[model samples]
Target: MRTSWSPAALDAALENVHRAGMPGLFAEVREGDRVWRGAAGVADTATGRPVTADMRHRVGSVTKTFTAAAVLRQVESGRIDLDAPIGRYLPELVPGERGDAITVRMLVNHTSGLAEYLPYAYPSLKAFPDLANTGPQSLEDHRFTRFDPVELIGMGVTAPAVGTPGGTPGVYSNTNYLLLGRLLERVTGTTAEECITRDVIERAGLRDTGFPTGPYVEGPHSLLYEAWFGMIDPPRDHSVQDMSWVGPTASLISTVADLNRFYGMLLAGEIVGPSSLAQMRRTVPVVSQEGKLIDYGLGLYPMEAPPGRDVFWGHGGTVWGGGTLAAIRADGKRRMAVAVNMQRWNRLDSAGRPRARPLDDALAAFHRVAMYG
Candidate 1:
């Protein structure tokens, strides 16, 4: 909260960003004791709410860190086995064919061969469920957003298989994490929100961080705009869909400050001990990069590696109108995460042209300041 950011410079960079269809951008950077924060453009263009470090953002894939951490807690407590077939924990979720072959380790590594049935996204608001389930108070919660994990798995099962039955070396599937959530629920006898808050959020005393629900729409919310009905209008609000769509794989909403606390604690072994951290950071190799292959650790991307090797170790995720990427340094020292509500107000790209991936430019611009500079 003490670092000085070049506000004028960030604002100017974002102006061109808006022209490119990016809605809202916010970021934080930490190197040793120095911390830099930036917020460019309006969070809710229609409502004219200026972006701030405290505003909550839907950190699409970064949510994986939370889930992975929670699971490691279970492992630390001896509540679950990392190498056992996930079906051992939740038999009902086990696919008849390859269920026993898929292990918790595979799920974390995205090697479970379960092709993404829905990209862990809304596919559009119409597909979101009405909802049923309890949630922590910090978040307007939804446990069952539309279809339960069972139903979604059924849909995934009916579709063509991705890799061979057993997701071996390299297959990224959100379904694995969905099953992981179910497994966590079975092992802990609690919902993901309960575990996430108890093990991490609440423990860290994160105030403004949580999954927003109905009441969220009425308060200091970032207005999300989407070009609806093919109109070149302002972004539309996304308060309608339940936060559950984020799934265990990637649905987390938090302030820049809360994210800082979470990652900081993570590295300090506040939430988990050293052994559990190792379990979560372990990487598995994959070979699908055209003429290359690489390793993806639990909840993280590649960083740097051998030929066709990818050592990028961050987690990247996109959902509905939200996108995010977060990761710690190779040594798990310096950590960075970004969140923004890509609420589309105008259907056009600030010039009557249709928009695609509206927040792309904002993401790039914010990273330039927080990561590069």
Candidate 2:
């Protein structure tokens, strides 16, 4: 049931998250014409600079939604076919029979069976499918490294297939999205970043969202801290890093307000035509990078809610240290976007599984109040 929400409730929840472990947190929540924004804790732990409700964040993976929309826009223009094999367009990248087997639709929904290149790209993380015990060496080494998308794609493509083409329970991989970015560039005859910025970000009228052109965020932003499941005792800051490793797949910088606005426009059918939006919302079961089953669409996913609560649709993103989540209610009447400064709080168990920490519960509590109220 929908209940009345006081500003105090939201503020308290946010503070709870900070007190739990986050170095900083900021969020925006809108219900109908009423909007609430809250911030708690510091943007810089060393200086104790306060975080604000409006600040740029490296919202990893959320870039996929924009990329997916751009491709769907191409679909609207009849320049691309959803069911067409990717090999048909970029055969040189995904050559041979394997390319013919993976469809654009499969890539969008992550059913293409491509393994994540993260392990291969960051050799220190090769110990996966269990990342809980992984060290931070690879991330540290590549902080300033500029990775070519093709080289990264090759790592994932040549890696053993995690699943079959068009398979169910598909594995979540950044490789699929990197390939999508290439597809966008192939069809648009321009950079993927430019196409998304012009077609999706600008079209949504989001002033604070864009692909980062440099190693640093240009505006007011918090320092992103990475804990690496407590491997780094003080949680090293990773706010300034060359984002080329993920490229168009996870390197977009944005704010909570911009995220809310972008998702609101997207769900309202203002960014893409209704047919394209429909295709973007078609979900398939996929194993997330977190090792949980999620209903993933093109670039969007359904936020699991209680039986009686309204379902929210959008996406969650995490870079090395920063994390973000933005969603609009299924009815498009309510929306929430949240950003946090620290990541990898869960401790690893003997089995190499992540054990939930207090911060996880605290963040969920804030989300319940932010989105459901």
Top candidate by TM-score: 2
For model 2, name the residue pairs that clash.
none
For residues 220-339, write the lDDT of model 2, one tens digit per residue: 999999988888788999998999999989999998998989999999999999988998899999999877899999899999997888899999999989999999899898889999
lDDT of 1: 0.60
Tens-digit lDDT track for model 1 on 1-373?
Answer: 2223464655565455656656666666666666656666677666676877566766666777778888888888898888888767776766554678877887777777766655223332221121112111211123235546666665554556666644457766667677778888888888876787788778788886665543243335465544442332444455455655445666666767677777777767788897876666677765432213666666655544334322324665555455566655554445566656663332334433434554555456655544433
Give all candidates' CA lDDT scores: 0.60, 0.90
Report the poorest 10 consecutive residues by lDDT, candidate 2. Answer: 124-133
Evaluate model 1: give its TM-score. Answer: 0.76
- Tell me the spans in candidate 1 whose CA falls farther than 4 Å from its real position: 1-16, 119-145, 165-169, 213-219, 227-235, 285-295, 302-313, 331-333, 343-362
Where model 2 places Cα greater than 4 Å from the true spot, the runs are: 1-3
